[model samples]
Target: MPVDIPGPASSVSVQHEPFDVGAEIAAIAAGRPAIGAVASFVGLVRELPGCPGGLSAMTLEHYPGMTDKALEDIVGQARGRWQLQDVRVIHRVGRLAPGDAIVLVVVAAAHRGEAFAACEFIMDYLKTRAPFWKKEETRDGGHWVDARDADDAAAARWDV
Candidate 1:
């Protein structure tokens, strides 16, 4: 019951296996010549900011139905606000080490403004609205990560 939505304009997937970012980007506008801009963002697991000796690894968990619905809602909102021609979202789960890819957002539009804004808007909402939980493995042991105020601020700026 993983969150994988297949559609002509929008695609979303939550998978444990790695994905090819390049191929994903290319597929968004494989045959469509109308797309003028393709904006994308890739999030990665990095060393925990406050960890003493740095993070060893991080694990992500999510409820299948809830996570998918939240992501779809975010994308739906973006589509309404912007003139996005295509959108793609991919999130990874389970054990992930620092430097590993965590999420990918791609948006295609007739102009750079719409594509860029839509990409960021979707990611911002996904950060705040998505049900994914994170746990970090540090020298002290595993600890459930807390929501960051910055993430809230990022999502809040959109005013969506």
Candidate 2:
């Protein structure tokens, strides 16, 4: 499901199509002279280490409305914490092959520090807070992916 946010400064989309990182970053920075820095992260599906036959593919699933709201809230939180100019988050759903892009997050601010910090913070929170389930497929079979302790720890450091 694609959600086009009402404002040009922010948007959250949960889609199956791959996104263009350059275009996304450019769109947010266009005509915005105040934006001095842009930070972005693009997540990709990779082979599972030590898994039999490696990872053939991965599937992501989410509840439409709920997922959008969760992502929007995350973007809002980032905006509240930093003096941001624009933010865009795109998370792909459905089947994805190895090396395929899974998610894209772009943040723009007047300074590099705020842009980088907010970008990292949003990703850390998204890892544990986003209401999405993932299934990894190998030649042997497929299994649901679970939350990781490292991810939780990453988010915890930013806690108030």
Candidate 3:
């Protein structure tokens, strides 16, 4: 689900292809001299601990329009709470193998605190609030993933 958010220093999208982290970061900083700090987080697919064998891959799916909307809402919430100068979120969908990049979050602000907090906030909220679904593939078999309780707890800290 490709997202279209206009007139703000933010861009969010869900795609079926890999992203270039360096390029994305450069894009965020281009023409934005106000940004004094930048923070980034990249999520990768890997075998869950205790699994019989390593995870071969993961298949991610999302409801097109809704997925983009939900991400936009999250970015909006982060912007409202922080002094952010720019933000970019890119999440990949479709089939992906272990070691593949799954998500990228880049945030820029006037200070490190704002950049770090907003980046963490967006990733935490995205884990719980976003509409994407994931299924894991292993040598043994494959199964749809269940939400983690820890993710919920992570998001809860920002309730205030």
Candidate 4:
């Protein structure tokens, strides 16, 4: 799918490489002179307490066509709501160890506020709407992560 923003130089990659915050920000801002500020967010796997089994790794699965469409829609919304120069989202799937990066979001805007807000909005929506399923691998076995009601509520806030 094509990126909605004009200044992004048309780059989007989804892979299992260890995510680097600095590299992602640089790629999103590359050759975009109008971008005065860039905002980025990275999500990582976390261990929870009181679980029956000890967490070891996480594996993510996503619907290809739907995932791409949802990301494109989120980016479009951010562009419409803010004067953003560019936006990019990269989400990794498959087995990931602890401290591994699961997702990265980057937003470029003329000002910091717009960039920050757009980045946040994309994350919020991704947490809820994106058709990505996660499997938590523990010492005992592996299980799919259930959808959280809290995530739904968070996305609902932007429904207007």
| lDDT scores of the candidates, listed in order | 0.88, 0.89, 0.89, 0.79
Please give each candidate's TM-score: 0.92, 0.94, 0.92, 0.87
- Most accurate candidate by TM-score: 2
What does candidate 2's lDDT look like per residue over 44-85, in tens digits?
998888896899899998887888888989999999999998
lDDT of 2: 0.89
Residue lDDT tens for model 3, 32-103: 889899999999998678897878889998878888788889999999999998889889899999899999
Give me the runs in candidate 2 sitting further than 4 Å from their true place.
1-10
lDDT, residue 159, candidate 4: 83
lDDT order, best first, reads 3, 2, 1, 4
TM-score computed on alpha carbons, candidate 2? 0.94
Residue 138, candidate 3: alpha-carbon lDDT: 86
Indicate the residue-level lDDT of 148 in model 3: 97
In the range 50-137, model 1's lDDT, one tens digit per residue, is 7787899999999888777788788999999999888888999999999999999999999999999999899889989999999999
Question: What digit string (tens of lDDT, one per residue) describes model 4 on residues 1-160?
Answer: 2222333444344556666789778876888799899998889888857676778999888776677678777788878999988887888877888888888888889999999888888888888877889999998888898988988888788883
Counted clashes in each candidate structure: 0, 0, 0, 0
